[model samples]
Target: GGILDVLDCTFEGNSTNLGRAIYNEQGATVNVLDCSFDSHHSSNNKKGAAIRNHGNMTIKNSTFSGNQGARSGGAIYSEGGAMAIELSSFSGNQALFGGAIYATVSPSTMTIEATTFVGNTAAQHGGAITQLFSNLEVSGSTFKRNIAQAEYGGAIGVFDSELVVSDNVFVANKDKTGA
Candidate 1:
């Protein structure tokens, strides 16, 4: 029922089991601009290291680096609503799934544009991003030197979802499963 805005801030070295940097719950809207999430680490099998969004969220011109999610979504985990991440960068993030981002649940939409993902790693799958049970559109992005260990999709992984990808660049991304 309310709108929250975070602008031009740096969130660094935050530690938590969930949403080490930011948490946006249902019925809320969040807009993040020109922010940076760095070294936000989860000590356990947590949901998100940087952000956990269950509602509407928009992040632009931001950066995420050295974040660690023990479970999934090292940079962002979005569900249950509309999400947009644009003109951003993610680097050196680690997770079991979606080292950079994980978007799930039904009726949710995510748009990513002009972003960059580099040197991210996932233990199971999706070294850069994992989209499940939702709609995703990514354009003009870059994925470089990312790795997925023991599974597939070193750059982007989508399962049972709608995906539209155009004009993106993927370089030196690999999965340990040889897939």
Candidate 2:
């Protein structure tokens, strides 16, 4: 509803719709600082199994592990506007599409800094992050051991989108088409 800040919160083993741990709507400004989301699930919808954003979101020093999405964004999903993630980790998450993170619907801003994405999987595209009509800026991150079962982008995908990637490491990512 207004500017929000979450610090040192943990979300694990939850099952629900939208975001398993969080869902933001109506252009709220939110910050998740030093939070953890692990083993969450989305029982319904194609949104975040761990977190969802519909406004300005900033995530720093977080972790997401072993989450599941019924359709999309096993770890995180962002729509509407700008989302900034720094020093985060996304590991062992799964989804039908965009196993780790998904940004879609419109031209949103995504900034990832000093993050890690490891051992995530997607049935279709973007084992780490999927961007549809969005802009992404990633720096000082690592993507390792992620897999894409079909389609492209073991670490990320930009569909009708722009990307600014710098100082990021992509290692041990697997795809059927070899990334």
Candidate 3:
């Protein structure tokens, strides 16, 4: 119904069943800028330690670190709708899948630019990002020292998704297969 804007905020050590710090339900639009989410946690089997977006969302100039999701998306998750993130940093986050971001929306788009993901860990796939059944565009990003303990894609994983990647760098990312 309306747009919510959050700026220059800090969310630290928050814990919840889902979306420990921020949750945007359907039909809501949110914009976050110059914020930090640190040491947030979601309960067991939950998703999104810092942000869970089922609506339209945009985040810029943000930082997420030491966040944990028991299931997926240690920092951010998008089940539907569109999301855009720019100039963000994700570090030391952990989850079962998608240590940094999980996007699983059909007929929706997610765009990320000029971001950095480092030292994130996932028990399964995508130590940094996972995109499933969605449209994803990533550019001018860097991923380093991320680890996927089980499956493929230590830096990123895509399944039944459309992905466009450009001007990105991946270094020292490790998985069961290799770095």
Candidate 4:
């Protein structure tokens, strides 16, 4: 278990094999504020391109743009964790699943508020976000121009999860699997 707090940071063009930028393990608590992650990437495995959280994470007033993943979670992979994202934006990220965010594990939780996701793309599913067997709440968010090619959930995908969504705007999102 660990405690980390990062504030007012700018992470750009960072790359790794699996889960780069910040890797939060189980039982760890991390807080990120006023940060910007741009053009960060992950390769040679299916994981997070910018951050991977397996514990607890809170991100506020942040921006993620142009991040790429070899497989899943172009910006974040939150598995078996509690994550909260507020007043953040994700744009132009690409992945095979969850173009911007991927979260899983039952009993794990995630909340999003006042966020924006735009122009993210996935080759398979969840062009912006994906949650499987988790609890997720999203409100006051905007999703635009996200694309899921040959798949489903152009903006968000929830599979066997508990979800509450309200006051969100989705525009121009496309899932072109059978279209």
Candidate 5:
């Protein structure tokens, strides 16, 4: 109902129906610092293999790798509220939609800075990130070797959202639609 803080934690080989590593519900806030999430997996048709936020979340200096989500958001997912991510890394994540991160809901706001995403893959769109009806801003990040097996936006995909990207690097990303 309020706030939760996590620091210097390691989550390995976690499996769950949703939010294998962490889940923040509505009206709550979560702060994660210097954490590591590795080899997390969501159950069949579930979303958010590593972390899922429905309220407010801040992540700094975290690492997510080898996570798998059956539906979307292999590394992280935010459905509502505000989120801030900085100095984080995501690699080798896989999902049906967003391989690394997914943000949805009209009133949601997100900001990502100084992050790295590499070798992520998605079956549909947005091998790195996918947003829908949200306000998003990304800066000083790097995306490399990400792939979308079908559809467009190997690095990012937006649907009915306000997006702002600045000072980011994209390299060797592939998508079926050549985006």
Candidate 6:
């Protein structure tokens, strides 16, 4: 098959570039189901230590934990196209920007529902999510204990973009913008 289906996979203890656990780019698509990405890191200017997307990706019933990005998108990053995430958990991830997730200039959109982001940190902005020139729809999500050390939007950043959030919880997040 031309599709990569990862079920009950565990990714942990990798370091180097961003998305130490997985990096999906150049219009590739990945479907992760009941998997775990944990305790990954990057060196300088690294991003998306757990998962990176420059394509169309989908994650369902997965967990991301303790990932770190030297630059941005500690747990996950998306650009260029659409990404769908559902019933997932992002916890204990850290980055210089978008500690948990980053969605940037894409031709399409991103959708996230029934997800949880907790104990993540961004040294600059958007402790949980940074949305730039893209479209995002989030429903039934929760963000807790996220931190932004420098700029703003502890939980989310909607910059020159369109975002729709419904039935979500933002709690105990630290940033200048206060999400």
The C-alpha stretches of model 2 lying farther than 4 A from their native spots are 17-19
Q: In model 5, which range of ten residues has the least summed lDDT?
A: 14-23
lDDT per residue for candidate 2 within 1-179, as digits (tens), equals: 69988999988798755546787776688899999898988876667888888888999999999999888889888886789999889999999778899898766889999999999999999988889988899999999989889988888867999899999999989888897
Segments in model 5 whose C-alpha atoms lie over 4 Å from true places: none
Per-prediction TM-score: 0.96, 0.95, 0.97, 0.96, 0.97, 0.93
The residue-by-residue lDDT of candidate 4 on 80-131, one tens digit each, is: 9999999999999999999999999977899999999999998888999989
Q: Over the full model, what C-alpha lDDT does candidate 2 score relative to the true structure?
A: 0.87
Estimate, for each residue in 1-179, the C-alpha lDDT of model 5 and write its tens digit: 99899999999998766647888999999999999999999977888999888999999999999999889898888898799999999999999999999899979999999999999998999999989899999999999999888987899888899999999999999899776
The local distance difference test score of model 5 is 0.91
Q: Model 3: which ten-residue window has the lowest total lDDT?
A: 14-23
Q: Return the lDDT, model 1, position 92.
A: 97
Query: What does the lDDT read for residue 72 in candidate 5?
Result: 83
Cα lDDT over the full model 6: 0.85
Per-residue CA lDDT of model 1 for 1-179, tens digit only, reads 69999999999998855557888988899999999999988866787899998999999999999999888798888887899989999999999999899999998899999999999998888989988899999999999988888788989878899999999999999998654
lDDT of 3 at 25: 88
Candidate 6 residue-wise lDDT, 46-105, digit = tens: 667787777778899999988888877888877776789999999988888899888888
Q: What RMSD does each model have against the real structure? A: 1.1, 1.2, 1.0, 1.3, 0.9, 1.6
* 1 versus 5: better TM-score goes to: 5
Backbone collisions counted per model: 0, 0, 0, 0, 0, 4
Comparing 4 and 5 by lDDT, which wins? 4
Inter-residue clash pairs, candidate 3: none
Which candidate do you rate higher for lDDT, 2 or 3? Answer: 3
Residue 28 C-alpha lDDT in model 2: 84
The per-residue C-alpha lDDT of model 6 at residue 167 equals 98
In candidate 1, how many Å is residue 134 off? 1.1
